[model samples]
Target: MTSTILNPYLEGNFAPVPDEVSVGDLPVTGTLPRELNGRYLRVGPNPTGPAATDVNHHWFAAHGMVHGVRLRDGRAEWYRNRFVQGDAPNHSPNTNILAHGGRLLALVEGGRPPVSIAPDLNRMATWDCDGALRGGVTAHPKIDPASGELHSVTYLLRPGSEHLRYVVIDATGKATHTAELPVPGVPLVHDMALTDTRVVVLDLPVTLSMAAAARVASGTPESGGEFPMRWTEEHPSRVGVLPRGGTAEQLRWFDAPRCYVFHVLNAYDNPDGSITMDVCRYDTVFRDEYRGPADVLPALARWTIDPARGTVSEQIMSDHSVEWPRIGPELVGRPHRYGWFGGIGADGLHLSDDVNRVRGGSLEPGPLVKFDTTTGEISTHHFGIGRVTQEPAFVPRPGAEAEDDGWILSVVHDAATDHSELVVLDAADVEADPIARVHLPRRVPFGFHGNWIADNDIGE
Candidate 1:
């Protein structure tokens, strides 16, 4: 990998797009080294703070306006910009959450948005989201264009644990219906994903040894058995698909892998009203499986869904380990391609050998990758600077003929300084260099998930 000592003050384009295409060329710019780059901080796979929902990568309809907050100068700054717009709120929850169309779409069991933490254990809340409500529109809401309704999942804390309730809301943020969901072998539900006709809930099983269980009863640190030591085999992963209407019956259930984050990449509704979800299942045999925090298990196999019968089929297109799976727009009558930054072993943060052969670390930034379902071929576009990256969101060009063909918008992290930048890529071929890079004046504190909501769509 090419290594360059990062200049804390050097700003401008660290690496500019190639004037000419080459397999191993890195971009260079003369801009002053701005210390405000995002490379200085690190955000883990699990998003911290506030309960927001509906974080689908491709959910935003357009971008005339966007609203959210960024942590800068050790403080939270609320933002309302015309970059993307639609009916989205700026409130931050205590857990990880985001919504589309005024609905609490997907839910994660982590810290909420609008949070502040320091090295000395300083903690403070900047915003308040009413996540404790059970049957109403949750902290985040997801709207289903096909069904013309907002979908939400609510969790109710009860004796010993919490149970979930699904709620459907109208466009006006009014709850229309509510139903209980089933999650066996799991005591905690981290996040829930939705298909047009079905809902998939990923649950984490509680495995406490008798001793730890007793300690929990005695209000003491549960010693050692609070979590199971079973690394790979039969992880606490489980998936459930429930119909959207007409009895809201469960159509299928599949075992899923334990994900570092709760949200599913994406699920599609099949012609038969069944659902398919792409998930990363971690195997138990890998001795190094429990490397990081037990909650942050390394990702393994990728599986496709068959919600009609509640089953999952693994797709072996790429044997490489993948993380943060995302679905692109459909192409050639097929659903959008699936992709995630990949690696050979644990610590998906680093580039593996397969990526090395190309430009030797030029692809080290863990290129934005895509998997064509029809051809099973993979393509990657890299930012020479190796830094942590998140699932890139595809923003279709205005008046683009095909949804699959458009501009890809992403937040890239620079390894040298740990700063992040908003980069635009050509969707058709991710291998191409960025079309535009907007450097934030300050570090946009690292975050887990986000979406692009256009302004025209949201009601005034």
Candidate 2:
């Protein structure tokens, strides 16, 4: 038997900060007001079918704070307190969370629930796609800071069926609008992004030919959508931008290269009048069709969505294979920093050939990268190799503080024991060690995305 117990390389004393920025660990609250009890009947695996753990086991993951909006005068305020409201009992198989509109929307991938496709593509726990399945919310809800409105995206599935549909929720936690983004193929919404006026979805449509479906049903990797179907390279996915109000109208749709299975980090307005977005992708398929070994360099593709032309253009950067690029102080001109986990290729981190073979291997946990598109200058601080650092949240300093630098709150994972720690770092210097490390009592499953939720305004 082998063990995985790795520790993050520390520069200064790994001590606690007396007054450092911190968040508390509290159970789901505010769920009572809605007259909702945190209980769900989980579906288990077929007992006569196989001697396996419950296949369709589902449970809530995380709750998000509700965004406060003033409808009378259009006054807007985003939460700053460190508490999560409601109960997120189910973990979205392929969804991310974001604050949008004057509310929060949980956008989810719309498609078939995982099943035992083959020996390699093992049966997904029955609980995998649990939730309000008819309309499973997955994508993160994004808030329009200026208007205080929120937006969310999700896919709807009928009980015991695979017919997928798309739905968007308004700021009030209600699925206000619905639509069917139909194609001959099955499309999944992995990640979504939002600007002040529009929302963009990174969709991957798998064209599982009838021939392929037969093979998967018979149990084989030689089947199920081509190993790498001719993904719409030039236009692999589609972006849907919906207006905040006005009947949740869709502003427009733009075609772009396939996003594969990646999530959009951030989308914000640029001073130069452009919309910037960051994404991570896995361009490989494993022998077991279900799980892909992390392999290759996840490219940090930059797109500038322009309303004038109603299209997105790629932004030239010094390199590719970067994962989780967020807008930060370095992108002050851009108003958002893109950040994500994964290692940088060419760096010493991608040491083992076996690792390189998997989709996300080949590189060490990468340095947090901040690129100023306005000047084309990039600042990077590699947070050591062994620590699997996930997405980062940029916290702006209080009034009269230097806007050039802010605090970055990131989840640091100890790859060895799989333990995670909440780490605070100076936004300006990535190389400088963490300002604080709030060790968690338990290991948090690797999550796709997260954001800050201030607690005070929830009662108001």
Q: Please estimate how well model 1 matches the true structure, expressed as its whole-model Cα lDDT.
A: 0.40
Worst window of 10 by summed lDDT in candidate 2: 37-46
Give the Cα lDDT of each candidate.
0.40, 0.40
Cα lDDT of model 2 by residue, 146-192, tens digit: 44444445444222333334444444444554554433344444456
TM-score of 1: 0.59
Model 2 clashes, total count: 69
Candidate 1 residue-pair clash tally: 65
> How do all models score by TM-score?
0.59, 0.58
Candidate 2 lDDT (Cα, 0 to 1): 0.40
Q: Write the per-residue lDDT of candidate 1 for residues 1-460, one digit (tens) a residue.
A: 9665232111121221111111111122222122111111222221212111112111111111121323222222222211111123432232233333432222322222223222111122222223322322233344565555656564432233334567665555455676666543324343456665556665544322234345435644322112222233344556666676423364355765444333345566667655555554433221232211222233434456654455666654454444445554332113445454433222233223343332211212245666665566667765764543555665455666764566655566666665456565676777776665644333333333454433233311
